[model samples]
Target: MSKGQPNEVTGRIFDGATLRKILAQVQPYRGRFVATGVLVVLLSGLVWVRPALIRIAVDDAMPTGDADLLLNVFLAVCGMLLFEALLQYRVTYLANWVAQSVSLDLRSKLFQHVAQFQLRYFDKTPVGTLVTRHVSDIDGIANVFSNGILNAIGDLLALLVVIGTMFWVDWKLTLLVLTPIPVLLLATRIFQRVIKKAFVDVRNQVSRMNEFVQEHVTGMHIVQAFGREKQEAKAFAAINASHRDANIRSVWAFSVFFPLVEMLSATSVGVLLWWGMQDVLVERMTLGILLQFILYVFMLYRPIRQLADRFNVLQMGIVNSDRVFKLLAREERIEDTEMARAPEQPIQLRGTIEFENVWFAYTDEEWVLEDVSFRVEPGESVAFVGPTGAGKSTIINLLNRFYVHQKGRILIDGKP
Candidate 1:
């Protein structure tokens, strides 16, 4: 969890504590959150209605020569479709609104937290790495609220409703049509496992690339002065290649999994046609019911296929959240106790400065200043002359309270 270290991928896709932290972000927008949930459930529950209406029009209205009933059913289907569209719009808008609001809040909090951190923290952490956290990682967390977890829940519910309705319509047909589902499920499980790792690698590579570019760009003068432009470009190319490879792995998983889903969907249709024709020939099932099963098969597989994708989105969000939270958890900020605060009113001073038995280190046991002592009387102009890396700047930093000396009594105006 150290700064600049790659995040470790957990065996589980979602962490409970992480999930709770994410949901906690929704507290301020609870009304929108609740409304989104309700709409998703409502939309899922109504998934079977249109198919049922289509069956009724085909079998009952048309066969009975009831033109009035046919017209009414058509109009009803149109109305239902429109209603679902409106509900979808509200859900999309509400989810994104909550997500964007939460994103803004988190970004602002992170910025303030990072700004207060000690210079030692920044010395060890790369600017590009922090940039990745502020930009790409936060975007991933936003996606969790907008399109990841919530949409995945809706897809799962719609899937169950579609399957349940299929069973109700004709249990035998449903069973036969679902024969290919086990294979599809197995494929999806593999895809999820593979893609999660790929995504984690992608994020890691992105951070590395960001860090490399940031450092090189900021030090372009050094690189040019040392005639190391080609060397730096080669290093950047290697990092960029790693990022590309990681993305290709994720793309490869999608390429394989989606085609497999389509093939399974087609197989289910074939199964339906093969078994349905037998029943139709024997007058045990009507054409209208067979057609309904076809539609139902599509509904069943569509959500199942989407479920895999949505799960990936959720997984990526969790990965990014883990990184962001780790950064937030760092205790690198200087704590200003009550005694450290400046007085409300300014007071004149004689300007005497003293550093008594000061010991300091930017890192563990690597002392930049070892038991150093100094004094500057009023009106005395003292210059700290030293070679590079000889604690000259460290002295100024300690005097300014930019860092706390490990063991020291730094007194200004005879005050300690």
Candidate 2:
């Protein structure tokens, strides 16, 4: 495989360089990101308020036996819910809008850049590989903005508020509820390492499968002509099987991760209840305060468990960004300098062509055409008679500047 080919898989995970490059692309939308962050913070605050409102309604209003206070608290909770819903909606909408805008900018730039690459690039690099980058890779980056970054931040903030409130209500119970955290964190770290590799494997396998299918379909005539259908089918089956295995590994990682998270969450709940009831019995904690703690624990674990999945999204996005940025970083090998501008009026061509001591080769120093000389005057029809690889197409290509000759003086109407 050539350097331009996409068969090589990059093994870098969580690279600072890749992260910075992706951030530079999203710099244009910093204002929207900041606004979304503010909304997330406000939403987190609102989420914290709901549990407190529940506690107040149960402990204060119910003891007073006052229907009016109960009604007011109920209305307050309803208003908060409505406000939170609006903020959530706005945050999601803005995040997705920014995501798609960034994807548009990225895809436009990628397509334009790929279009300018020399023919040799396409000769070595598969069309399906480039298509994957343009579509699949760009979509991955979009999900980073849409479902990864802002949402992860919101979850983290919500988790923090839950923890803070838990400690405020009762630090002892909070500590008890968090005893399973170390084990959960360890499990999450292992899952991250495994899934990161799995995601990279899946991406590489998908690219290979795409390249294989594309090349085979394009060369279907050759396969049929050579009577190699059965052989090709066997080859395709091997590639397809590898792709399936890669996907299965990724699914297996998810299966293990989610169940572990659920178990940890359940353990936290069990610990909170078992220890919390003792405090309630000793008059150290009220029923309402204990109920509030239980609510906070549930809120905390939900986000904590979701954090692992969000991290997977972030990791996958980073990997895709690396590939996309690598493609964009390629420099155009062919320069368009001093191109001839159109004259104010059209000038008729003399239809004369000349080639003097032309030397050319597709690769270095292995000449296909050496010291070739030819001339044809205006209105004269001429043809070069030769075997199959005798520089016939090469002459046309050089005259058209599809491939520039290494050493040549090719002139059309006396202009080189």
Q: Report the number of the highest-TM-score candidate.
A: 1
Q: Write down the lDDT of every candidate, Cα atoms only.
A: 0.88, 0.83
Structural similarity to truth (TM-score) of each candidate: 0.95, 0.90
Summed over model 2, clashes come to 0
TM-score of 2: 0.90
Error of 2 at 62 (Å): 2.8
Candidate 2 Cα misplacement greater than 4 A, ranges: 1-6, 337-357, 363-367, 375-380, 407-416
